[model samples]
Target: MAAEASPAPYADLGGENTGPVYTQSKGDTLAVRGYDVVSYFTGDGVPVEGSQEFTVRYEGYDYRFASKDNADAFVAEPAKYAPAYGGYCAWAIGANDALAPGDPNVYKIVDDKLYLNFSEDVATKWNADIPGFIASADVNYPTHAPDEHFQD
Candidate 1:
């Protein structure tokens, strides 16, 4: 019998994808819909930018926070405060560290650590090799440099 060829060891080989990705910023706790940060599983979205409490829906999920302070706290340590994949797009992470938009449903917790990706297509690839790809991505991310990865 003839030998079979191995599949390419990449989430997205072409790396020609455009999508939203999880962003890490100082005050990024505010949800895309302008809702305050809250336990994805527990509370509804509150207005983190102000002291007022409000509710908002994202990706078909409802979230809430008691007050702006609570939302700020949640945003400060999202990995510890938000649900898995609740704040980041998963597929993006799996495929060449592409920036994926946040998906509240798709998530994974490895060694109690949270990571996010872009889309379901990207996520499927990410789930294939959690440790290996993540390690490589982490290593590659820092040294990727602005000019090499980004052209502004």
Candidate 2:
């Protein structure tokens, strides 16, 4: 028989994927909603739309880029561009211990690590105690890392 589908969509691709991939569920619009992850750090703190032509696949998920330079930067240092908590809401990870989709536009960088949030409100709260929240999320992350998204 085929393996049972997870109540959640989390999958451990193991070495096959090279690392953790963002939850690219079937028919999901795009990775990080097609926003250029590199743009958040390399230029003005804004979400830049990525093009389909300039794309790279890492960890079995496709990340689109606004330019070839951005795509190359990601290929060179993926950890520097990929968001923390597997692109889940940072506040939800620390506060509620939940997995919520992070809005690519609502983001922040602390200690050179990118963080995403469900909304401005959650980002605000997450900003209140960045260190504390980071500590909490750091602990919770490993437990939840294997799964891309959680239903409950």
Candidate 3:
């Protein structure tokens, strides 16, 4: 299907939004770099690039989906699909409480929540101590993150 412009904003899907969902730039509201967040949980667990035609705006960010089904799934339960730590690099948030770009291609699903890392190398480090890092991030993220997207 063809893509379209993002639709009007929807109600803020309540969650402990650590920070603004990561986007390519300050003006960019596309979460997960336009990847289908729900795709991470379905099929082979490989995330698929999303189309603007299946977009949903939630929590001040626009999430795209590979299909209408995925979009509808997100609309039903955004917190379940939205990336943790506001789509920031998992390692950065967990280890340093810093905001770093999370590569959509490098991700993990732990305890049913999706987490993203900066790169393969970062993912390796993060994978070494997932639980520990999550514990640290769970404490650090809400306290340190500003209520805005990174001004890249």
> What is the C-alpha lDDT profile of model 1 across 7-120, one tens digit per residue?
322111122112222333422323333333443333342223322243332332333455545555544554464433334444444346543355444445566555545556
Whole-model Cα lDDT of every candidate shown, in order: 0.42, 0.74, 0.84
lDDT of 3 by residue, 1-152 (tens): 88985455433354444466788887777889989999999999999999877878786678888888888899899889999988989998888877899999999999999999999999999999999999998887877544555554
lDDT by residue (tens digit), candidate 2, 1-152: 99974232122222233223345464353568778899999867787988877766666566778888988888788878988887878888888777788889899999998898989998999989989988998777777645345552
**TM-score ranking from best candidate downward:** 3, 2, 1
lDDT winner among the candidates?
3
Alpha-carbon deviation at 90 in model 2, angstroms: 0.5
Model 2 earns a TM-score of 0.80
Say which prediction, candidate 2 or candidate 3, comes out ahead on TM-score: 3
Q: Which of 1 and 3 is ahead in lDDT?
A: 3
lDDT of 3: 0.84
Off by over 4 Å in 1: 1-79, 82-91, 143-152
Number of clashes in every candidate structure? 23, 0, 0
